[model samples]
Target: MIGLVLAAGAGRRLRPHTDTLPKALVPVDGDLSVLDLTLRNFSEIGLTEAAVVVGYRKEAVYARKDELQAAYGLKLTLIDNDRAEEWNNAYSLWCARDVLKQGAVLANGDTVHPVSVERTLLDSRGGGRRIILALDTAKRLADEEMKVIAADGRGVRQITKLMDPAAATGEYIGVTLIEPEAAEALADALKATFERDPDLYYEDGYQELVDRGFRIDVAPIGDVPWVEIDNHDDLARGREIACLY
Candidate 1:
């Protein structure tokens, strides 16, 4: 399976840095960028080919694509998202519908986590689960987090940002495995989600699939530190987490 990364968002909260470069290109550990760590993780787990959905500052990624590919020893395909600045990630992910048909271990470019998260999802593959999300059940929930409510912590009952923090089980860490069997259906769900509302998160697509009776499972990464870089505060936290990786 090829690796997939959604690096399209402008990350308005992270301005100046995101003014010229995408959030994925923001440096976390000195010169090492969020995209650098993501590609390294994918390579560590044998995902030698990766497709990155780029928008906001797409040219920035193109400028460094060759360097990143050489450093990670992986082939990179950049997918353009024309509506990236105007739309949310639900459409950004939908832009990758064609490449995802080959099966993919997809990760959000702005999230900082170790290769262990990638390993957990890869190891749990092929057991009747078409979609497997890397969840952090151990983290404290906040209103801004992409939360999930699972039935007995195995089957995902719901995934949304509007859920009450007290009632949610955990956060969906923006990493997922999409098997070939579920690719077409997932793409369709993503399309429906974006059509209904351009501001919807890709998690909305997961909810759509769950509503359609797809068996999407969760693999909880207990007590594992990870941070989704959105604003300046998160960038600091991401640096700390990057050291752990």
Candidate 2:
């Protein structure tokens, strides 16, 4: 299995810092960047190889690839998303489809969380579940959060940022375990999603899979503090929680 990171977005909300570096390279704690923490988490979880999808000032990542590899003791593969500045992450994730044959544990590069999040997805991977999403059922939902809804006693029914907060059971924490059995189907779904609308998110791909009768269940991260760094405020929150890891 491999570790995958979606680090392509421009993150315009984070200026100055993002002007020269990708959001993944933005420092959240001291001199350690978001990508640093992600690679560390993957290393701790026994993922020796990780594929990072890069775009938007990707040279920064290329420059530090060797240094990062040496620090984490993990092999790194850089996947370029040429359309990252024009499209959403569905296309970015689809670019790494060919490498996920052995199954993959994928996470957003901008999200700051403890290594426990990765451990939870890894520990819950059996029982024939092809895909398991790390969900934060304890977080209070807002309109911007990527929300999820369960089906009639089944797995995920839908995942979207447009869903009503009251109807959402939880926020999909941007971490997922994808068994090899579901990689191809997920790739196809991501393809269809991007072809339909380049602006759609990778979560839309999960919704497509759910609509196709695939079981994408959730692993609840109970009371585990995590923050998706999107702006100045989120960066502050990330700094506060990152030390706990």
Candidate 3:
């Protein structure tokens, strides 16, 4: 399966330190940065190819391509999103349209998790074009975290960033497997959303899928040690979870 590493973000939450460096290059664990450890984990999980979507400070990320390749001996694809500032995660996903295949592993560069996720997705044997790993919000969720209300049995669901304070349910772990058809449909949905509302976030695309009756399955990511490194506080927590390696 192909891997899509989403490194395209201005990292507005991570200031000062990120003013000069990309968030993906920031140190997470003892020695390895978020990008470094993330790739290592994917390599171990039987990944054949990887595409890193770089945007802000992409030069820094592009410069290290050779080093990472030499270290892992893996073929890596780098896609740039010059307009990352105007859009959200959905735009980044759109930037890699040329690189995305039939079944692609979608990962957020700012977050890190165990690579066993490959096996988890494989076990589900999804029939849809896109399926996301649904983390248990009960485990722990924040106001800024993305959440979903999945349908019964099938992974199909309506996903969104928290809209209500009291309706907390499931969290969205960044790991996702998007089938080519799903990716295309997602691109279409995003295009429509943007045409109407230029300020729309990528989450809108997922909601569109549900509206159109696309069976976007939700695979349970229960109890998996995953962390979204938004700042220094998250960095420490990520290290603790990284120790699971």
Candidate 4:
């Protein structure tokens, strides 16, 4: 499986840093950006190839593509998302449909996590599961977290940001293992999600999958030091924990 990164968001919350570069390029560890850590994690997991969905100042990524490749020792394929500035990540993810068909370990470019999260997902592969999401059961769920509601055998029953924190099973940490068997359906679901409401998140596509009777399992990452950088505070937390990773 290849590594897939959804790095198309403009991240308006992140100012000057995102003026020219995408959130993925925002540095958390000195010169090492979030994308750098992601690529490094992928390379450590033996994924020799990676596809990045780029938009909203994508030229920044293009300029550093060769440098990132050489640093990670992996080939990179960039998927363009023309509507990144106008739409949500559901469409950005849809842009990489072909790459998803090849199976992939997808990580949100703004997330800073350790290689253990990827290893946890990889270790949980098989047993007829098509898609496995990295769920953080240890984190205290809040209104901003993308919460999940899952059961022992029922898998994920719901995933949304609007859900009450009291009822959530955990938070999806933005890492997922998409098996080839679920790719086509996932792509279709993503298409439907964005076409229905261009503002919907890709997690809504996962909800679409559940609505269609597809089983999506969850792999808890346990107590892990990870942060999804969305603002200055998040970036600060990312810097503090990313170095530990």
* Model number with the top TM-score: 4
Q: Give stretches of model 3 more than 4 Å off.
A: 127-130, 165-168
Name the candidate that leads on lDDT: 4
> Tens-digit lDDT track for model 3 on 38-101?
7886777777678899988888888899998777667888998877777676767767776665
Question: Which ten residues in a row are the worst by lDDT in model 1?
Answer: 146-155
Clashes of 2: 0
> Candidate 3 has what TM-score?
0.90
Superposed Cα RMSD, model 4 = 0.6
lDDT of 1 by residue, 11-53 (tens): 8899888889899999999899989999999999987899999
RMSD of each: 1.1, 1.0, 2.1, 0.6
What's the lDDT for residue 22 in model 4?
96
The TM-score that candidate 4 achieves is: 0.99
Off by over 4 Å in 1: none
> What C-alpha lDDT does candidate 3 achieve relative to the native structure?
0.73
Candidate 4 backbone collisions, by pair: none
Q: Estimated TM-score per prediction?
A: 0.97, 0.98, 0.90, 0.99
**Cα lDDT tens digits for candidate 4, 1-245:** 89999999999999998998899999999999999999999999999999999998999999999999999999999999999999999999999999988999999999999999999999999899999999999998889999999999989999999999999999999999999989999999999999999999999999999999999999999998999999999999999998997
On lDDT, the stronger of 2 and 3 is 2
lDDT of 2 by residue, 1-245 (tens): 99899998888888978999999999988989889999999999888999999999999999999999999998999999999999999999999998778799899989998899889988887778899999998888999999999764488988999988999989999999999989899999999999999999999999999999989999888888889999989988999988877
TM-score, candidate number 1: 0.97
Q: Candidate 4 local accuracy as lDDT?
A: 0.96
